[model samples]
Target: MEYICSVCTGAYILGATGLLDGKKATTHHLALKVLQEKYPEIQVISDNKVVHDGNIITSGGVSSGINMSLYLVEQILGKTAADRTAKTIEFVH
Candidate 1:
């Protein structure tokens, strides 16, 4: 695939085609290298606890996905709502 030519673009090629262009995102650290090389337009920030570039939000790893998801929930429903969801999901961090 042209999109994943550089890295493991296969991971999110569909997402990229649909929503990743002109946005920011990150993938699993193991997939970082290829992502960077393949998608130079994407701001591949490896240091972010959670990378949010407009509509494209990418987490470093599975654990980070929880954080990002909570952040989104908090944004939409406020901290109280997010906290409740986190608690319901048993997400500690």
Candidate 2:
């Protein structure tokens, strides 16, 4: 199954489960240092709003979840569907 983490802290939960080991991930900018310190095995991305590695996807914060959701939609249903969904929701991206 695929895992999508909507918030920074959610990545911590996945990390604890060893799902994020050796994977690229991200969290809230403020917590980036903490995440790296806690999970040295994870390559914490400090600049990305969303990070996708394998079947797990992690977003920086609440707002980035929107991007993550759109990405998931595109991945599973294709870009046309994702674009329509974004437009229907009045989301700019």
Candidate 3:
């Protein structure tokens, strides 16, 4: 999920609901600290543009959202399909 939004409230809500609990996730660099504090159960990983914890996938900023989508497409479809979609969106992954 893309956690870039107003303040860190949206991200905090999602994480607090256990969606991100016991999962490795990330958010916009600016919100990392808040994320960690709000969701202590979640392992707020940094140093990555994208972090996937099983069914729960978390992304940093808007650009990272694009990357995460490409990752999901590649997982669901084949690499060829993912490549095509990325190309259509002018994104490289």
In terms of TM-score, which candidate is strongest?
2
What global local distance difference test value does model 3 have? 0.74
Clash totals, every prediction: 1, 0, 0
What ranges in model 1 sit over 4 Å off?
A: 1-11, 14-18
| Model 1 C-alpha lDDT per residue in residues 20-82, reported as the tens digit of each score | 666667777887777777777766767765776654556776777678778777767799999
Sorted by lDDT (best first), the order is 2, 3, 1
Runs off by more than 4 Å, candidate 3: 1-10
Please identify which of the two predictions, 1 or 3, would achieve the higher TM-score against the true structure.
Answer: 3
Model 3 scores worst on lDDT over the 10 consecutive residues at 1-10
| Candidate 3 lDDT tens digits, 1-93 | 333222223456668677777878888889999889877898988888778667666778777877877877777787999999999988778
Top-scoring candidate (lDDT): 2
- Model 1's alpha-carbon lDDT is 0.65
Error of 2 at 30 (Å): 0.9
Pairs with steric clashes in candidate 3: none
Clashing pairs in 1: 7-34
Evaluate model 1: give its TM-score: 0.72
Instruction: Give the lDDT of residue 60 in candidate 3.
Output: 82
